[model samples]
Target: MTTGNIKPTKEKKSRKSKPVVNEKSPLLPTKHEEDAAGFDEFNGASFSGAVFNLSTTIVGAGIMALPATMKVLGLIPGIALIIFTAFLTDASIELLLRFSRSSKSVSYGGLMGDTFGKYGRMLLQICVLVNNVGVLIVYMIIIGDVLSGTTSSGIHHPGVLEGWFGVHWWNGRTSILLITTLAVFAPLASLKRIDSLKFTSALSVALAVVFLVITVGITVFKLFSGTVLMPRLFPDVHDLASFFKLFTVVPVLVTAYICHYNVHSIDNELEDNTQIKAVVRTSLTLCSSVYVMTSLFGFLLFGDGTLDDVLSNFDSNLGIPFGSMLNDAVRISYAAHLMLVFPIVFYPLRLNLDGLLFPSARPLTSDNARFALLSTSLIGLIFLGANFIPSIWDAFQFTGATAAVCIGFIFPAAVTLRLVNLISNLICHQLSFCHLKESRFQFSLK
Candidate 1:
C-alpha cells in the first residue's frame, strides 16, 4: 500500500550510508589500525606464551652471577635490590606499554623514533645491539664452559663433553660452539616470528627451573647434612673503596631486569593487547622469584667464596649422591637453556639492525636470504666475542652500566616525563583558550 513511502525509507538509509563512508574515507588507516596489521603476523602468541618468553628473557645468564652479586651486596641488600629492580622494571615496562599504545609504535626503536626523533631511535638501536651482543657472547661463553670446560692456573677442569669423552678435537670449545651454532642455534634464529619460538622458550624456562631446583636441592641437602656454609647477611666493608665497590652489583641487578626492550615486542604479539600489563607483571614476578631463589641458594651453597660464575662453584666435587651427575646436568641443562635463550634475545637485535640498515625494506622475516645472512654475521661476531672475552661478568658490567641502564631506566622515565609534559601543555592550552573565549564574550556583551 504505501510503496511510495518506502522510497523515503530507502533515501533515509542512503543518507545514513554517506556519513559512514565519509567517516572511513581516509586514504590510510589510523596509526592503531596500522599497528594492528603490522602486528598481525606474530599475533598468535597466547598470554602464557608471552609470559614464558619474557620470563626466559629476564632470567638468563644473569642469574648465575646473582649469587656473586649477593656476595658483594650481602643477602639483605642483594635480595632487596632484586625486588627493587623488578618493581622498577615493571613500572618502566608499564611506561613502555602506555607510550607504545599511545604512539602506536610496535618496536622499541619505533617508540624511540616517535619520542626522541631519529637520533633517539638510533640510540635505542645501538643500546639494544650492544646489550644483545653482550648477552649472546655470554651465552656462547657459558656454553663453551659447559661443553669443553676451562683451564686456570695450569689446572684443567673437564667440561661435559670432556668429562664424557676425555680430551678430543670435537669436544674443544671452538669445535663445540661451531657445532652448536650450525646444528642448533642458526636454525632456531632463522625462525621468522617470536611466537613460533614459544615452545622453545617454554623449554628454556623449564631448564632454568631445573637449574634453580638443582641449586636449591643441593643447598638444602648440604644444610640438613650440616655441610652448608653460612652466607653473610651484609658485605664486609674494609676500606671506602671496598665499600663503594658494592655499588657495582647494582649494574648487574639492573642488567638482569633489562627485558624492557622486548616488552613492546611481546605486547604486540599478545592475543589480547589489553593483557600486556598483566603479562608483563606475571613475567617480572616469576623471573624475580626465580632469581632470588637461585641466588639465595647459590650463595648459601658457596657463601663469600662464591665465584662470579656460579657454575664455576660447582667445579669442585660435591660429596652427594650422583654429585658428578647432578653437576653435569645443571651445567649442560643451563647451557642448553642459554642456547634457546640466544635466539629470543637475538630476535630483537636482528630486527633493530634491520630497521637501522634497511628501514624502508620489507620485513627481514619476509626476506629469507637477508635474514639468514644477518643471523649468520651477528652470530659469528658473538662467537668471536665469546671466545675472546674472559669473563661474562665484565661484559655484563659494561653493557649493564651503559646500554642496559639507558634502555631499561633512563629512556622509559624520560618518555613518561615527555608524555606528561605534553598532556599538561594541552590541558593548559585548552583552559587558556576557554578563558580567552569567556573574556571575549563578556567584552562583547558589555
Candidate 2:
C-alpha cells in the first residue's frame, strides 16, 4: 500500500489523530510542558519566598514618602489613595498574569512582544529601564541621606557614617554610596535569579517591620505624653495651586505600588506557577497594611512638618526615649532595606535590557560574562545618578508620572483588552464556520 494510494478513510483517521486546538484551554499550559520548553525553572521559589520578594519590591522608598503625601492630600484622602492604588495595582497585575498565561510569555518584555511586536517590546524595555534606574538612584539618595547626613542652613545633622567618621571626606555621600554600591549592592545585583534573594528579601521585610514598629511606638508614646501633633483629615485648599497640586499625590501613590514590573519575573520563579494570584494578593495586602501603619504613625508624629522623606522627620533633638538611638536605628535599618531592594528592582531592569541589547543572545541569567557586564554598567549609571540627583522626590515624580504610569496602568490594560478582542474574533470565526458547514449539509440533503 503505497502512501500515494492510501485510502481516504485512513487519511481521515490520521487527521483525526492530530491535536485539536479547541480541546485545550488556550491560556493554561501544563507545568511539565512549559518546563521542557525551558520557559521556567521549576522548584526555584516557594510561596513564602515569592511573597517576601514581591513585598520587598513594593514597599521601598515609596512608603517613606507616603506620610508626606498625607501632608499634601490630608489624612483621609492620602490613606484612601494608598488603598485605591493598591487595588488598582492588584488589578493591573492580574491583567498582566492573564495575558501572560494566554500568550505563554515569560517576561514583561516578552508579553509586550507577543502582543504588540518589536516596538511594543522596546517600549516596555525602555520604560523598565527608566523606572528602575530612577528608583535605584532614589535608593542611593536615601542611603546617602541616612549614612551621610544632609546639611541644611549651615546646621549639620550627623549621618550614621558622618557621626562615626566625624565629617571626613571619605564619610561623605559620594564616598559612602561608592563603598556601599561596590561592597554591597553589586554583589546582590549579580545574583542570577530573583528567587535566590529570598533570604535577603526576608531580612529587608523584617527591617521594614522594625522601622514601622519604631514609628508606631514613638507615635503612641508621644500621644500618651501629649506631644504628638494631630494631622488634619483634609487639606485646607487655600488656593487654586494647592487644590490642583492635590492631584500630584496620585503619581506618588502610583509609584508607591509600582511592583507590576516584577510581577512576571516573580511568577516565573514560583515552584507552583498557579499560585501567582495568591502570592500577589498576599503581598499587596501586607504592603498595604505596612503603608497604612507607617503613614498614619509618621503623619501623627510629624504632622505638617513631615518632609518628603519621612526619615528626615527624625532628629536627635526629639527628646523621646532613646531618641538619638531610634533615629540611627530607623535610618540605618530602612537604608539597609533599600540596599536589599535594589537587587529586586534591578532584576527586571537587567532582563529587559538583555532583551533589547542582545535579543538573540542566550538568556542573560545563563550568561555569566554578559550578566556581569550588564549589572556593572547599570550600577555605574545608577551610581552617577545618585551622586548628582540632589532630591529623590524629583526623581520619583518624573519617573512615576511617565514610566511607572505606563508599566503599571496603561500597558497591562491595553494588552489584556487586545487579548480579549483576539479571543472574541476567534470565537466568532469558529461559530461562523460551523454555521456554514451545517448550511451546506442541509442543502445537500434537500
Winner by TM-score: 1
| Segments in model 2 whose C-alpha atoms lie over 4 Å from true places | 1-42, 151-157, 434-446
> Could you give candidate 2's per-residue lDDT for residues 321-373 as a string of tens digits?
78888888888899999999989888778777776787655555567788889
Cα lDDT tens digits, model 1, 1-446, are: 55755643321112112111110111111233333343222224577998988988888889888999988988998999899889989888888878876886666666777777778877888888998999889888888877898764466667888878889999999999999999988999988667778999999999999999998899899999999867899888999999899878877898898887777666655666667788888988899999999989999998877777788667678889999989988898898899899888988888777766775565555677887788888989998998899877888888888999998999999888988898999999999999999999999999
Positional deviation of 40 in candidate 1, in angstroms? 4.9
**Per-residue lDDT of 398 in model 2:** 90
Per model, how many backbone clashes are there? 0, 0
lDDT of each: 0.80, 0.80
TM-score between model 1 and native: 0.90
- Model 2 pairs in collision: none
